[model samples]
Structure formats: structure tokens, C-alpha cells
Target chain A: MLKEVTAATFENEVLQSDKPVLVDFNADWCGPCQMLKPTLDKLAEELDNVKVVSVNIDNEDEIAYKYNVSSIPCLVMFEGGAEVRRSVGLKPRPELIKFING
Target chain B: MYDIIIIGAGPAGMTAAIYARRASKSVLVLEALTYGGQIINTPDIENYPVAAHISGFEFATKVYEQAEALGAEFVFEKAVGITDSGTCKKVKTTENEYECKAVIIATGSANRKLGIEGEDGLVGRGVSYCATCDGAFYRGKTVAVAGGGNTALEDALYLADLAEKVYIVHRRDSFRGDETTVNTLKQRSNVEFVYNSNVTKLIADKRLTAIEVTDKLTGETREIPVDGLFVAIGRVPENRGFAQLITLDDAGYISAGEDCLTNVPGIFAAGDGRTKDVRQLVTAASDGAVAATAAVRFVASLE
Candidate 1:
């Protein structure tokens, strides 16, 4: 499981974080999001350069809307309080790692 | 080194793991993502014999657990390439490479997309390929599904209960899916069928607002206001990485027969990635059994 972030803590937890954060924009009903949970957990446990967190679109529609997140399991990498890259759908681990590292 | 290395953890690959492990050959299944492949997005599976009325996720979990209980090691890694050395084969991945006596390539297919303008850009905003995964976001909104296959029909049917209205657009007059399912859709009050048409353009600003559909017979076009567009056209096999090592058809599917034998010896292809007429869950399982059995024989002959 990933650290859940809401509209209240989005700034300090993600934008102002010291290290790069991989934010997973997801929802409870999205099957792909649930399917990606284990992989995200693995990444959280293994990787050191980045922190993995998730925001449920259902609870924080404002944040989801602000980021133009229309898809579930959307991965956005944040650095220096700015969005660096975003991947829309479920992808292979190597590709996800590349999206975060590259 | 292992006796068999299976690329992919979909039904075919997992089933191959089960069979190979049962035969007492050390087995390993490498999956790029989680297990279940495209089947995970499925809501319910009714067509598979004996296992009636089970969700796709449950079925996948059952198979995965069975393989794991049978002592098949699973590694979540993306396989990049394969090297065949007659008796010993190497499976290269994004993380590590492992040696195996035989290999089974069962990487399944992915959802096909409609290459219209704004289609790729608006994914999640209003355009979605998977209804089961993304349909909940469009509750009480008007949506359109494009395709005449079972997948499209099923997506439209599934969305009819949630969305305010559903428009099922197909290029052909008749559907290639089961007639019973078509009739079921006909009985729905919120479902409408648009035949002989194709979705040519997506009308959007920040999100999807409508779609431009063209009549194939008349060349006339109409823009339909829809909150979402669900594309269930079909699927294309994921075999680009192995096109150089093995044989692939024009559509990029591994060239293989029902026996699952690839062009290279001691390496086999199974599941939706392989070139075959049928690509059902049962057939993929059958291919796994056949491929594993053949792989066991090949390894035995080498010894």
C-alpha cells in the first residue's frame, strides 16, 4: 500500500518533499488501480531515490482536476514542487521505473 | 538455472507454470505487470466451461495461487529478449537474466485503440479503452462504445446500467459477438445501436465532450454529445521484443501452431501472443499444457 495523500496534505507531502515523489492518482473502483497496488508496494519497498504515494480521486476531486487527471492509475512524478512527467495507464514495471528515474 | 522460464504471467504462462511444476521441472514465471493480463479488467466470465459466473480477477487469482502452491516461482520483471543455445536458453529481462532449459513465450495481447485525433490526448478525461476499469467515473453520464465485437457489446451493456444513455457504434450492421448478448442489449431502455458508422474524431477541450461519427455507407458525419467514449475495438498481440528472435505474422503475433512450437527449438509460444485462430481463456490454457508438455519432452531428450 502507498501513503494516501489528500487535498489537505498535497503540498507538503508531494510538492515540498525533499526527494522526488511518484504520485499515483487512483480511485477505489478502478480495477487497474487495485491491480497495480502490489507493484507500487514493491517499488516503495525497493527504490530509494523516490517516494511512492497515492491520491484517491474520489476524495480529492479538486487535486485530481487541478492536475488534469482523468484516468485512474495515472502516475505523476514531482520534483522541485513541479510536475515532471506523467504516465496515463497501467504499464510494465520497467517502463514505470523509467518514467520515475528518467 | 531453471528447467523452464515462462515469459508472462497471464493464463497461458501461469498454466504452463502449473504443468511444468507438476512435471517436476523447476519453473519460473516472469510477469511485466501483475498477473492476469487483460483478464483482470473483466467484470465477470460466463463463457469458460466448468468455471461459471466467476469474476476475471477471482479466476486469475485461483490460477496464480494454484501455480504458486505447486512451487512455481514468479518474478515480476519485464522480459526484453531471449537467447537460444540449443540445450541452454537465456531469458533477459529489465532486471536480470536467467538460464533455463526451455522457454515459453505467452505474453498476451493489449487493447486496440482507435487512431482518431484527440483520442490519445483525451484518455481518462472522456476517452477510455476499458469500461470495467474506468466506467464508474461516468455514472449518470452519456457514453458511446465503438466496435461490433463481444468486447464492445459487453462494454456498452455494462455501461447502460450506470450511464444516463449509451450509444453503441459499430462499422458493420451486425455484430460479431453472440446474438444472445446483442438481444440482451436490445432489451435495455438506455442502450441505442448506431450501425455502419465509425468514430472519426473526438471533440474535446480539456476533457472529452462529444465525438464525430461518420456513416461508412453515406460518408455523412454527425457529432454526438457524449460524456465518455469507450473503445472496445479488439486486441493486438504484444510481441515486438521477440520479433527478431522468433517468427511473427504481419500483426506482430508469434508464429506458432496449436502445439505452441515456435521457429526456434526448445522455445515455444502460447496464449494470445501466438498466431492462432482462437484466443480464448480455455484455448490459452490448452496451449500452456501443450507447450509445457513439449518443453518437458525436449529437456528430457537433451539429457
Candidate 2:
């Protein structure tokens, strides 16, 4: 299961994590986000070196506002307690890997 | 002569350039406007196969970069005309003329405007032609879609998926779209059908606020508040200049033969500008590949 994080816990849970963290900033009503959830979960399960968490924009306003989340289904990657890469929406599994490896 | 001179840097043109470049052919793409063409204004492309989902701008940008990576040269110039010299073709842009062994016309099409007041000024702001491009921006907001055609229905359905409510304002009493689509839209609780209504004015300054719809039956003018208005009336192919050089259909679209051959030798047409049954991006890309392949074969025959 992808760890559910709130605005209060996002920084500590995702940004300050020891392992590489993939934070999914999305909303429940978004169809594309729903389509992307399974893929994200699968990636988390397969890749043990990475930690995956989800943040609901509707519930977590501070983190969303900080990231300037204009659109939903945004995926931000953090490695060793720092922001590394961020993607706006759902990307192909292979493309996501390329982003991680790059 | 240069191997190929592909007109327009749209998806069709860019794809052709990529293929021709990979085949070691010298490819030059003449573009009037930006790289993406009509697809640039589009927000997202969900129906495009293999991509799953991506913004049309992003997808077109990826194609542009990929074509560039394969060594395709791009020039930003509006093509005025093309003259065939039997063995070679001379493509005349606004600034200069280019001589090439073969040419591919991929000028594509443009969105047909509503022609109502404030329509032109509010294009990207509130009045939009592409729902996939602007739908996400109108999330939880209300929007209106004009026209009753297939494109209009699809746009309304797509917008309904994102927007809180989608009002389909059509001039006719019934939609001319597919029955399944009409049924599906009618089933959607958020979609409202405003029949026999035509948009008289698009009122907005910084962004779209509301639209004045005039009822054809009662001549009643009603103002509906909405954040966005999607116009899906139709498209006009950009083939005015090329019409004098090639055989064009009644609608000013290019008339291409079975092998994507234009009336003029060494000249071919592809994508929405060409005479084809389908005008989807997949088919457009396929047309580009086919046209480039045919042009390559035609060039090889010269030797």
C-alpha cells in the first residue's frame, strides 16, 4: 500500500526520508489520477529501494499550495531528504524509470 | 536536389522528417507557425495509442525533439507556393525558395471560429477549440460547448468528465453525433442540452465569464455563466496556397492518390490537409510515414 501522507507529515515522511521517495499529489475526483494509482502502487511494490506515498490535494492544502499544484496527479520525487525531480501527471512506467535513473 | 522538403512542422510533417532523416535522407521542415501546430493548443491527448495519456503540446514537443535528434532541419517560414520542375520541386516560402527531390504537404487544418462577438479575442483565455487541452483547467467549474456535431459531442463528453457541469449548446434540436454517444451524454447527470440555441456573444475580459445564447425558436437571449466555452463546430484545412499548385477537393483539401501522390509529380499530401477518410493523430502519423516512404522510393527512381 502506498503510504498516505498529509500536509503536516509530507515533509518528514517524504522529503526527509532516508530512501528515495515518490510522492503522488492527486485528488479523488480526478479520473487520470485513479488510472495512475494502480501503476504507482505496482512500482512501489516492485522497487524496494524506493518509498511511495500519496497526498490528497483536497485534504492537504499546504503541501499542494507549496508545490503550486495547479493540476492533479502530480508526481514529485525526493531522494536523500531533498527534492530531485517532479512530474506534472501520469507518465509511462518506462519513462518514470528513466526519470529515476537519470 | 535535397531529399525531402516537408511542409508544416505539425505531427504529420515532423513524423515524416523523422523517418526520412533516419533513412539517411536530407529532410527540411518548413513551418509557418510554432512546431506543434493545432495540437499545441490541445491540453491532453487521451485517445492516442501507446501514450496512455499526455498533453498534445508535450507529445508534439517529444516528436519535434525526436525528429531533431534524427538530424532533420526545421525552418520557420510560411510557404507561399510550390513549383514542380518534373525532376525536382521548388517550394516557395515567404522569404526564400527551396529546391528538393520530393515534397510532402502537411499543412494540416485550423479550428473554425464561432464568428460571434469576442470569440477571437478570448480564444485561449475563455473561448477554446480544444477540450482536451483546457478541460483540466476548468475542473469543478461550468463550461459550454457549441455545435451538435461529432466533435462537439465528444468535446462536451470529455469536458463533462472534468468540469462540474457541461452545457451542450447546439443550433439544432437533436445532435448529429453517434447514437451511443448521444445516449451516453443524455445519461450523464451533469450534462445539459440547450437545443435550438446559438451563441451570439462570448463575454469576457481577462477570462471567459459567461455567454449570450440566442434561441432560434423564440428569439430569446439568455446569458449563462461559465468559466470556459469550447467551440467544436468544424475545421478548415490550410490549403489555400497549395490549391493553385495541386488538385484540391471542393472543401479546399488536397487530393492525394492511393500512394499519397498529389496531382503534381514529386509532390504529396498528408494529414488533415490531404484527402483521407480519417484525420486522427495516429492516421496522420501513418500518412506521414507512408508519404515519406513513397517519396523515398520516388527519389530512388531518379537515380
Candidate 3:
């Protein structure tokens, strides 16, 4: 099941995960965000060892602002509550896994 | 070892090379064709900020020279595939193979063709695709635009400023374009919206003379006398080579992270090939810079 994450639960769902958590911060109005969703979901299913969650930045502006997310559909990967990798805009799963493993 | 290997020598790839080289990373750019990508085919580019009006070749030359001056090394080769074998990624070309710590894919998109008769034959002579680049050429001339989408409508509106008459031809009676564009075109005396019509053939011997448009409803064929024909149907991402290595959307565009990272680690895609809402050159360049920076950090992490 795809876990829906908000700013309120971002800390609990992603920041505290034992495995590397990939957060897809997105919004509905963003066209690129919509295009990147299916890929992210597939990646989450394929890479079960890595925790994948999504956060709607539109619903949670504070978290987006805290992360300095000026653009929607930003991906921030956290390991042990620290941001190990962060990227903005649309990206492929191979590159995301590279960041996680690099 | 090079920090990033950027594929395609387009605006995005060049801009990424500039940034990546500036960031103290050794950058290698691989190009299948000549540098500049699709922008080379454009006749004139006006929207590129500083330059008011410049030919496509001139603008591309400036970028090419700038990237070269910045210590970026360019290699001419066609990239076939990439393999991520846990140690280092291997980029395969027809002639040779290259290994790099990280990769940045800046391959741009290609315009979708209408596939009508004479469309391919009269490509440069009297037929054109990009309005921003080809509009000024038809100053006070008559031109016909095919398709009713936003890109087509926008091209019609832009052509209205330069052409004596602009015809907006569509297959359907109703257009999917915005209300503002439709309203503006309707208000313009020079612009005419031709509904339920499709171009059966582009008629031109040496140059574009006219187009054979057939009324879909009435089944009547009529020839519209025009000097130029601009096709603004749509575009398709040219991501065939790496589709198997990375995830692609239904439209064959690379699925990228917000930062332009692909499904594989240390391999990122940017610009028109990657799924983006906007495919403008400025946005493509921005994506390139972002992907390069991310690649830099990723390469650093390899150690």
C-alpha cells in the first residue's frame, strides 16, 4: 500500500524510518508532479527495502517551505532522520536508487 | 575520473556542462550528431533573453564556444545503452564503451509529424514547425497552421503579428485550446479558424505554394493559396535508447525525480526527454543545471 504522508506525519513516517525513506513532495495542480507519480509508485513497489512515501506540498506548505521547495514534485531522501539526497523536478528510478546507494 | 557524462549536446546539456565544469568536476559531453541538437534546425530564435533576434546556428555556436571554453570535453558518439553493474556505470556506444561515476541525460525531444503528403518533402522550403523561429520569415505573407491545440493556436496568434493572413486548420469542429487564444484569434481580422478540416496534401513544387485541405464533414476538397505552412501538432520525447534502462511514461518520456534523477542510481535525465510540463529551452537548461548538481553530489557519495 502507498503511504500518504503530510507535514504532520512527515517526521513519523519518513524521518524516523530505519530504512532510507524517499519522500515525493508533490501537488495536484502540478503537471510534472502528476507525470512523475506512477514512476515513483512503481519504484516504491519494486524497491521494498527502501521506504517510499508521498507528501502533498500544497496541503502542507510549512514542510515544503522548511525544505526550501520552490517547485512541486520534489524528492528528498532521508536516512536516519538526515537528508542524504535531495532532488527537484522529475527523475527516473535508477537515478534515485543511485542516490540511495551512493 | 569524470564526475558526469552528459549525453546530447543540446542547450540543456551545454548548460549542464558549464555548471558542472564550474563546480570543479571534470565533465564529458557525448554527442551522436553535431552539437546544438534540435535548436540547430530552428531558423531564428527570439525568446533567448539577451539576443533580440539571432539565427539558430549563431545562437548554438555561442553556447558551443562557451561550453568549450569552460574546460568541458566533448566526444562525438551515439550512446546505445547504459548498464549499472554496482561498481561503475558503463555507457555503450556503437564504437566504444565508457565508464563513469555518474551520468546526466540531456537528450531533447523531437517534433511529432503530421504524416500527410508533401509534409516531409517541403520541410525547409516552405513548411516549418517552430513558430518562434520561423514566424519572422513570413512577414506580410500568408501561412496555414494545422492543429487546434495550444501550441498550434499559439503559433497562429504569433504568426498573426507577422503574416498577412493566418489560417488555423483543425480536424475537429471544436478546439482544445484555451478560451483566450481562441478569442484572440477570432478577434484578429488576419486570422481565420477553419474547423472540421484537415490538410490532405502540402502542395509545392520548388517552394510552398498552397495546401490541399479537405472538409471532413462535407467531404469537399479546397486548395488554400499560402506561402508558408507551420505545423504545431505536438512533440514526442526521443528517449528510445534508454527506455529499457530507465522508467518511461506512456508518452516515452523518462520518468525523473524532481531533480531529474532517473530510476538508476547516479544516472539522471533532464530536459525534453524527461517528463516535464514545460518543454521550453529555458526550462530545459534549468533542468540540466539541476541534474548536473545532483550528479556532482552523487559522484561525491561514491567514495
- The Cα error of candidate 1 at residue B97, in Å, is 4.6
Tens-digit lDDT string for candidate 2 (B177-226):
79899999999999999999999988775567999999999999999998
Ranking by DockQ: 1, 2, 3
Docking class of 3: incorrect
Scoring the B chain of model 1 against the true B chain gives a TM-score of 0.90
Task: State the interface C-alpha RMSD of candidate 3.
Answer: 17.6
Residue pair clashes in candidate 2: B42-B133, B43-B133, B44-B132
Over B1-303, each residue of candidate 3 has an lDDT whose tens digit, in order, gives 567889988888998898889888888898875677776545567787888887665666788899999999998787888888754888887778888889888888877888987676566456777676556557788999998899899899999999999998899988877989899889999998788998888887666799989999999999999988888878887778888888999999899856898888889998888888887777878888899899889887877
Best by TM-score: 1
- Please tell me the interface RMSD, in Å, for model 2: 9.9
lDDT of 1 by residue, A76-102 (tens): 899989988788887867777788887
Fnat (0 to 1) per candidate:
0.52, 0.05, 0.00
Expressed as tens digits, the lDDT of each residue in B195-239 for candidate 1 is 999999999987888899999999999999998999989998888
Docking quality of model 2: it rates as incorrect
Ranking by TM-score: 1, 2, 3
**Model 2 misplaced stretches (Cα beyond 4 Å):** A1-102, B39-58, B205-207, B217-220
**Candidate 3 global Cα RMSD:** 22.4
In Å, residue B90's CA in model 2 sits off its true spot by: 2.0
